[model samples]
Target: MAIVDEELPTTIFDFLPCFFQVIGIMVLVSWLNPWAFIPSGIATMCMLYIRYRFAHCSRDLKRLEGITRSPFYSYLTSTIHGLKVIRSCHAENICASEFFSHVDTNTRVEYLFLTTTRWAVIRFDWVTVFFVAIVTLLSIGLRVFGRQFSSADIALTLSYSLSLMGLLQWTIRQSVEIETKMTSVERILEYCSLGQETSVQRLPKYEPSINWPSHGRIVFDNVSISYFQDSPLVLRGISLNIEPG
Candidate 1:
């Protein structure tokens, strides 16, 4: 579960640079007094949307951990129980169909999620390219208009803007991913903190061993067992003895 949670952030981090580059190009266009900021801002919103979608996916994935596990375990137990009937009836094909159906449902859901995410990333990339072209054209126009901006200044702005955009985009993506992952982490911690069941066969060292004298007698002078501090005793002493034949 931790591994699954970690993967989302890692994936987002890996693709963050492209998003930043797009924003940087927009900033450059803005510097040249062009409307490049418009598309860039739109692209930023798109990126935010993508992050929201992924955050939702991460949460769904975590939820699936429980939902799928339950059905899968149920299927396993049912399969095992019906194995004899399956073999006797030669129902291999039927079993295979059932198994694959479950697998296909899971696969379809995952594929849909991936496809949507991929489309968002690709769209952002295109937006970035569009903004870069706008900035370039605007820069040329500014030169023609006698604004006299240096090539080095343009280059530096583009570089720094791209870097900053990229860093910020990645930071936002990572934050969403972390928030999603924390849900899974909390569940895991809750599970881990649960108290273990006591073993029936184990007894404390101070407990008396089962031994008998020649007369075969037993005693319970003051025995009691209580489940909670405030609860009445479930069992109480009523001494008895028995003799061997």
Candidate 2:
């Protein structure tokens, strides 16, 4: 899903273009007033720093949202399939409560994720404000020092400097989003790499006879089971016996 929905189109249509715009505009702004690079460079560094911090938080939030969302959908699906049985058992209220509980939990996580995004955007806006202010001051200082920048050059520099705010924010956001979405691909690859159970094979020369187990008894001892190797055991240390009746 991430591969199709995000990685290809977002990278092509969004991140790359914004990234190039940032670079090209910065270069052109510097050509107007070489001193302009200082504030732009500072703002770029600050944006990267903010992005690093925000990415870690947003990545975890996205993962949590995914985790919380699955149970909601899973429960909703199971409830749909079991509606008749639930009604017959007079468990509608209980089922509804459970469903709403899942909804509440999912909503909470989603809200937290959104609020964090808003917080990052506000901080990005602040950084952009400071960047523009410094650029304006630099322009004034250059003029006072008889560096004589044309009105057109000053306007272009200021305009591009203002535009950089949104472009930088979008680039950082998209890049982090791409990284977070890649986690889905990571999970898929991990699932693909898991060990599979081998199929039983019977050869003509080494086949077991139908009545080989004449005792009609089976036994198990100290068995442990888990769905995945890295996951905790669901069943541990069980012993059982089945004897011929």
Candidate 3:
């Protein structure tokens, strides 16, 4: 899933193929003169709108997550770097207030975006259910009044419509989630690219006596040390010997 988001084009691109497929299905169902076409189209449109909103919401969430993770460290480091000016100017409270304000903004944005998306999804789902009920009633009435459509035909149409609606909704929802998580994929890739610690090569172990010396002697014929990368050596050559006591 993560790889799909990372490798797949943006949310718009990711949704295009599915969107086209659903449109094709809707057209086919309409041509078939199914009793469920009207309700199914309505449901499909609602689901698509919800899906678009969800994609945007997901993007926001990914950004929020990124900010909350590494961005926090950057913020803190910057704040610390400016501590001297803040202290000197007696603006510690100002700095604190600014930091808190940014944090509050992030919190509000995240909470509101998630809440709105959830509520919208629930509302649209209810609307779809209502449409489904209406379609079922209409199918029943047509079957009774006209006697042109069979009970089985009506049932099949309704079932097919409902199933198509469900499939499209699920597909769009899954795609939105994947698009949103794409940001995390990018982050993970970036993290992986960071330098990794060199691993020690495995070697055969050598067993030693339990009564081995606790300390070892050091003998150096000459040693030198340097402090700076571009500077001359600090310590000159010297000989030293020391025995562990």
In terms of lDDT, the best-performing candidate is 2
Best by TM-score: 2
lDDT value, residue 32 of candidate 1 = 58
Which pairs clash (backbone N, Cα, C closer than 3 Å) in model 3? none
The true-versus-predicted C-alpha distance at residue 31 of model 1, in Å, is 9.0
C-alpha lDDT score of every prediction, in listed order: 0.63, 0.85, 0.69
lDDT digits (tens) for residues 1-245 of candidate 3 = 44454545555565677667767766766655465677776776777777777678678776675666455557678989988888999998887887777777677767876776686668666766876787788788887897767777676667656766655765676576667667777777778899986764435463545876556977777887676547899888978999886
Q: lDDT of candidate 1 vs native?
A: 0.63
Residue 186 miss distance in model 1 (angstroms):
5.2
C-alpha lDDT of candidate 2 relative to the true structure? 0.85
Model 2 lDDT tens row, 1-245: 65646564766578888889888988888898888899888998998998889999888887788789889999999999998999999999999999999999999989998998898889999999999999998888777686688778788889988997778889998998877676667667777999998776557986868988778788778889887769999999989998878
Which segments of candidate 2 are over 4 A away from where they belong? 2-8, 197-245
List ranges where model 3 is wrong by over 4 Å.
1-35, 71-113, 185-245
Which one wins by lDDT: 1 or 2? 2
| Candidate 1 local lDDT, 1-245, one digit each (tens) | 74555675675665576556655556665675444466456656766777776778766764565455455667768989999999999998898788777776666656665665566457556655665665567566666686677777666555654554555456555665556556666767888999998755535875656762436556565778788658999988756555455
Ranking the candidates on lDDT from highest down gives 2, 3, 1
Error of 1 at 26 (Å): 9.9
